[model samples]
Structures are given as structure tokens and as C-alpha cells.
Target: MIDSFLTSYKIILASNSPRRKQFLTDLKIPFEVKTANIDEVYPDHLVKGEITDYLAKLKAAPLEKDLKDNQILITSDTIVWHNDTALGKPVNEAEAFSMLSNLSGTNHQVISSVCLTTKKQQLVESVTTEVTFKDLTPEEINYYIANYQPFDKAGAYGIQEWIGYIGITSIAGSYNNVVGLPTAKFYELLKKLV
Candidate 1:
């Protein structure tokens, strides 16, 4: 289905995330992976979705100049927002534990933003998913950290992982958004373009 819609453009996914790659592949949209190393720093005043929007666009900027007429570059970023603070990818096991601990028995927002850059136009959009966790025990958190090692994931959790299967009580929005990409919103955007 997506093949017919996306055939006019050569899609390039500018991310290192396996989940994002899988999302595109599952959609049956042909794309190639290209990653750019960029500092994801944003101004301190930016909050919530702004931070992700900035980072996603930052990831796309370098590729903007090089995009061929037929190439459409997609870049994305996700953040765990709790208590007015943004929890990004943890730098270490200790930080991951702390992030998960903070998330225990609380409601947090998973915000994902995507930037689409083509030769003539650029667009950025974001989706927010509210996720609630049941109170997590130290033993459970430690077990997950030791085995899954979610240091690379924001909020130190993956909704499709073991922790999510057993720890999360409920969620209010797109489950795929929490995984890193919002396929429904993304597909709508692509449909508009093609």
C-alpha cells in the first residue's frame, strides 16, 4: 500500500534507531538508512515538544543541503517528559535506574517529533503519548536494567520490552509513539506529500 504512495520519492531515514527502521519496513515503505552525527543540545528555555522538535530538525539540517530532488529525508527524536523535566537517553546504568525510578508510579509524556526535508520544502511535526506506570519494585527495576540495559532509550524503558509488558499499567496515546516513532501521524503526513 505504501509502495504505491511512496514510489515517486526516494525515502531516506536519518536515524540509527532499529525501531524506526522496523516501523518503516513494516509500513512497506522502501527506505535507506543514513545517520548524521549532530550535537542534540537545545536552548534551556525550550520545553517538552520544543526540545524534540529542535533536535529532530537539527538531525535533518545537514542532510537538507545534500538531498536530491527525489530524496525525502526523515529524522526524529523522542523524549520522556515528567514533572516539567525532559528525560533523554541515559548516559549510564545508574542514570537509567534513576530515570526509571523517577517514572515509577507516575504519569509521564512521551513526545516524539519528526522532521521531513525534501528539496523544496521542510516540515516538522510531533506527537505526545501519556504513559502511566504502576509502582515498580526495586527488584523489578534492577532486573530489567540488568537484562534489558535500556540506556539507549529515553525514560530508560521500551514499551514493547519486558518492563512494559509487566510494569506499565496503562497508556493514553499511540503505543508506537512511545517506541520512538508515531506511525499513524507519520503515515498521514506522507500521504499528504505523495
Candidate 2:
């Protein structure tokens, strides 16, 4: 459905995440992989969607001058918010354990922001998914941390992994948003922009 609109445009995905790559690919949209080293830090006062939006736009800022007239650059950021705090990727196993412990048997928000930019204009939006986790045992948490090594994932966990399979009790929004990108919303926005 999007192929017709995107026929003359070049799509560039500026992320190292395989999931985001696969999501775009699965949409039958051809794109190239491009990444830039952007600091993901946001202002200390930013919260929830603000933080994700800032980070997503930050990731795209470096590519502004590189954009061609007919090329679209996509950038995204995902974070887990629990108890009014944002949980980013874990720095170590200890932090992973602590994050999981705090998330066990709790409801949290997974917020993902996506930015689509061209040389002429920029569009940014975010999706928030509410995830409820069942009470996780110590053994379960340990097994997941040791096996999955979720250091690269926000909130120290991946919802598509074993931990998600066993720990998630309910979710109130897009599962893909929790994974990394909100595919439906992304496609919808692309349709409008294309």
C-alpha cells in the first residue's frame, strides 16, 4: 500500500536495532542502514514522552544536512517508565537485576518515539504502551538476565523474550511499540507524509 507513495523516495533508517530494520523491511519498504553517534541524554527535567521525543530528534539531528530532497530519514527512541522514572539500558548485570526486581508484578509504560525527517521538513510522534508484569520469582529473573543479557534493551528486558513470555500479564497498547517501533502508527504517518 505504501510502495506507490514511496516509489520515488529513498528511505534511510538511522538505527542499529535489528528489530526496527526488520519492521521496516517487513513493510516491504526498501531502506538503507545509517547510524550516527548521538548522545541519548535528555534534559533532567524532561519526563515520559518528552524524553523519548527529545532523544529521537537528537538521533536525527546529525543527519539533517545529509538528507537529500527525496530522501526520508527515520530515527527512534524507546524507554521504559515505571513509578515516575525512566529505565534505560542497563549498564551491568546488577542494574539489570535491580530493574527487573523493581518491575516485577508492576505496571509500567513503554514509550517509543519516532522521527521522520527530510531536508524540507520533520515529523515526530510517540506511542505509549501500558505493560503489566506478573509477579516474577528470583529464579525467573536470574535465568532471564543470565541468558538474555538484556543490557541493550530499555528497562533491562525485552517483551518478546522469555521474560516477556513468562512475566507479562497484560498490555494496553501496541506490543510492537514496546519492542522498539510503533509499526502501525509509523506506517500511518508515512502514508500521510508520502
Q: Which ten contiguous residues of candidate 2 have the minimum total lDDT?
A: 185-194
Give one digit per residue, the lDDT tens place, for model 1 in 1-194. Answer: 55765877899999989999999999888999998889889999999989999999999998889999888999999999999999999998889989999999999999999888898888889999999999999899999999999988999999999999999999999999999999998887777677
Across 1-194, the per-residue lDDT of candidate 2 in tens digits comes to: 67777898999999999889989888889999999997788999999999999999999999879898989999999999999999999999999999999999999999999999988888889999999999999999999999999999999999999999999999999999999999988987788786
| Candidate 2 runs further than 4 Å off | none
Best by lDDT: 2
lDDT of each: 0.92, 0.93
Clashing pairs in 2: none
Candidate 1 root-mean-square deviation in Å: 1.0
RMSD after Cα superposition, model 2: 0.8
Evaluate residue 64 in candidate 1 and report its C-alpha lDDT on the 0 to 100 scale. 88
The residue-level lDDT of candidate 2 at 113 comes to 93
Candidate 1 regions exceeding 4 Å error are none
